[model samples]
Target: MRQAVRSQFTAQRAPWALHRRPFSTSYTRSGYADTLRNLRIGSHTRVIFQGFTGKQATANARDSLAWGTKIVGGVTPGRSGEQHLGLPVLPTVRQAVEQLKPDATAIYVAAHQAAAAIEEAIEAEVPLVVAVAEHIPLHDMLRIHSILKTQSKSRLVGPNSPGIISAVGKCRIGFQPLPCFSPGRVAIIAKSGTLSYETVASTTRAGLGQSLCIGIGGDILPGTDFCEALAAVEHDPDTDAIALIGEIGGIAEMEAASWIREYRSRAVSPKPIVGLIAGIHEVPGRVMGHAGAFTALDEPDAKAKITALVNAGVTMVHHPSDIGEVLREKLQGGSSSRQGILSGLGFGSQRRQMSTVSRRHRTSAQRAVPQQKRHLYLSTAQSVGLLIETDRTIRSGSPAATANSQYLVGVGIDRSSRMPCIIAGHPLDVLSEGHLKRFPFDFQRGPVDIPAEQIASHLGLRNQQTAIDSLSRIIKSLVTIFYEKEAFLLISHLMETDKSLTVVSARFGFDDAAFRIAGRHQQLHEMRDAAAEDPSELEAEQSGIVYLKLAGDDATVGTLVNGAGLAMNTVDALARLGGRAANFLDTGGKATSETVKKSFEVILRDERVRVVFVNIFGGLTLGDMIARGIILAFEELSLTVPVVVRIRGTNEREGQQLIARSGLPLFAFDSFDEAAAKAIELSRR
Candidate 1:
């Protein structure tokens, strides 16, 4: 057992870098997946580590090497003539380039210095660079992009990304968890790092593998987006289908969906695309974990993205676990098999044919059929490839063609009576004598405590919080059963809330399952809306801020920053100085003066906002424009919100002069720390 475990672990270890294929003579970029594959770093591509001595760099380097990544050298400023992990460490990227001429460079540097590291590699003319550092200022990225787009011949993958991996080529750049990947024909492109991993795992488990996986960073503006990735995959000869995982925020998913729609309309044989979008349950104006995951009032969210993709004829997966089964069913043009467990429980082979029997024949064979098992009406997505019919006549011809409308039935036993019952909404009298003789089973007969009796009992003994705590586990268990069986169900359960007996029922299909609590006649849509509204209660209350409204009112310090990183820092600075922020508003980069003024308006709208701090570091943006907006907002609102402004970068002097000369109570500062400290102090008064 020990030896077997060791062998498995060893097999799971990353493969060594593949031998370099001859450099492609043509660098002209193509529009399809082939283009991405053409320039992709493979076994032959030598990689250099920037920040090689750093802990993360060293550890990742080891994994890259173990996985057969051909890492040629390392680069660290002022660390020339050193050695790291038996590789030469040059003082600069230029030196490493001059010596090893590596094809790619992976950056592992602090957020403050990440841009400079990328600049160094670009200056050295490296062909490919994967930037793993995150939290760099927005202005720095603009500058880095300028360098990357012009003077450098390098292609930048990410500044805040997990990187890219190609299973078939045996090359991985970035920090992807590699074991989930298997060499197959499907290509996975995702915006979220963890979501991509989960999807890949699902695909691998379902016997469908991947050709490559790209994590396009969760930032609002990563170096690359879904459109470019999709274009690359379109031309890849090896990839048969594309699996896209997107989250809320940004127009990238919409862009990709639009492109797919056009591609499908034009192409003779368009490849199948299956998509799973996260943040379907997200609230507008609230940011999830990703820095780029903020949904504005008018911008597209998960629902819109899903609708667009589905309209474009993409097979939509409601859950990550369903990716593999969906892909196989869609690509193979058939049904998926999900009856292993049921069959093991002695439910004979799914393909068994019963002789032609009338209603009388079924009655006569009632004793032959097991009385301990129940009948279940199951309907599954066409992509899941499961069609198990029990106690029913089989029709000839393709079953999958009518999969959208056909319902399959499976048999199971009632836990208490040990008698057979059907999950379908029907009367027990319609079934054979196998039923344990349970009542009406009609929709009118409400409040049956069969499927959810344990949940109701458990809730009885628990407080609201405790009951809510177990809700996730129960939901997960329920969802898992559906996924495992590749089916959807409309079922009812009993519950007691507010000491009133309520028959709770839900239609479970897709990710957005609807549920209802019966007051009398059971209004489902209202109950579903009520249930859905609870998740984003804070969002439903406020419409402008990116997160829940911070506590503090009319005299508290509020931060108006241009980037997520700066906003987070300002919040932390206020906390450290014994002040609580009233709200956080990030006016994204490249904002016009009008946009900046609009941002100020949002901050000023907060009733609790007292001392507003505006911090702007304009790299691509003009500080003067931002200053103009602030002055305009102050004049228009005729407000008494004492404001502090700190402007840096391009046109900083002019912006400061405009704010300082304004005959208003606006204060200007030279630095962030000073501005934050003064804002916190002023808020107290």
Candidate 2:
């Protein structure tokens, strides 16, 4: 991978364009075209528009054509056989390909029809597809994504996005402003389309121009992820430094940080990355802006994302203006307060009036010791009695320990021989001898003062016993269970012991399973294993992977759209719907005639796919995509299994028109329940 020049400015004028040069092919495959000067966008590229007749589609198409896009044709079922802006229009993508033989497509359909449009594009064998619609249904997006994954050669950009622009050449395929952008040495990748413009504006302001500006979509499941884009940037020589703009959603930032660390540690030529993460407001369960923008876990929030990138040594900024300043500092090694001042300005009002009075006190809690650390010891004289008593405690909180001890001692024991003795428990014994060597105990602080003398006395003795037993339990049963399952041992001990023993045991088990379970349950309970009729049932089972088959109806498409979001929801819904999906497949709206054909081919290709549910919502996608797919499957692939489809939305009338025209026996439905029911029924059949 060649390193692109870092644009430099003299504060009085814009930087000059770096001379074009070829980059090693290694980086090209990683999609880091922005870092190389001579990175080429193949001229053989072909294009199809899903909603080619729409105003937005027409305007973008005209601009794209003028910008050197090789748009082959478009799909508008009802308007098929017509011409728009001098581009031929076909009823389906299959027909367009037959006419134009193009390799890429741009979908400018409505959100509702986004899934079908994408599916159609894929079927046509277009290597790349970009969707410019926003608010596409989550499920539909996933189905389209599944199709993309199956056909790895093809890539889908977004159901909501500004799209991609290759500075190496004039390949403007989406809705980003071209005037503010110029091909240079820097690669700008962002989550927000508008923010991408802001980033480019800042770069240009700093006399640094972009090599390529790619909006990976604000949605969670975009065609390209941060890591994918970064890999591309890393390989481009023309790119001196990369600027990344992320938002609150997913672990992509963290993942990128890890990858960057690995790459740097491996002595790879590291490109300095400037990171900015957006979205600080708390909006539970609602994606910000893009349908796929969502945080699955709390740690992936904006603050955490910034921290991760900062820790990874990337330049950080809060304001768009600071972007240029940081880039200049990194490239030129100059003092800059761009980030600090911008952040201070952005946070000024809130900081000025901020109050800590109402803020909740935060504290770090210690982790529980592993079960292997919880050692129990008793004098040999009282071993038998202690065993009986300890057996009771183990039975309650430590079933595994109790069971193991029982198995070791033989299942049956004579009660008369059982003599109780002093026993102690400590959950922290798992720490190494080195840790215990530095154990903190302020013995001079004189055992903690207690209001209750009885409780205090018992605690003191128990503490001593635990310390002694920690070393003494080298022989008697040394049991280790996960910290989480320690309750069983604690509960059994509490049930079988007196107040003094309980106090001593509790002290050793302080902050252990006993406390945790008690806190959650609000009751001291004994753990008991459910009895099985057959002992064979108790045999341990090895872990194995099981693949599931996921099918959807129109409603499912409406609910989940982004690939990741859709995959998550599909897996969750399948479990909820009393079945499981093997993998995710989303035939995007405006799926060309060929994409529809290929989708079935991919699904049937999966041996694990015992059944398939064809979920379609007629939104941006015409029923033609689904209808053509079914017809193609039967005609070319000879598919004979079960298939169910539910179509509704924009071009729905045309989609239904195709379905009626095809005369195929597709299980169709108007409602989600009906579709789900049909899918379930077909799977059973």
Q: Under the 3 Å rule for N, CA and C atoms, how many clashes does model 2 have?
A: 77
lDDT of each: 0.56, 0.48
RMSDs, each prediction? 26.1, 23.6
Runs of candidate 1 with Cα error greater than 4 angstroms are: 1-39, 335-685
lDDT of 1: 0.56
- Runs of candidate 2 with Cα error greater than 4 angstroms are 1-44, 78-81, 281-286, 333-335, 340-685
Best by TM-score: 1
* lDDT (10s digit) by residue, model 1, range 420-507: 2224211222233222222111111111223332332333433443433233223323323333332223232324244332223222
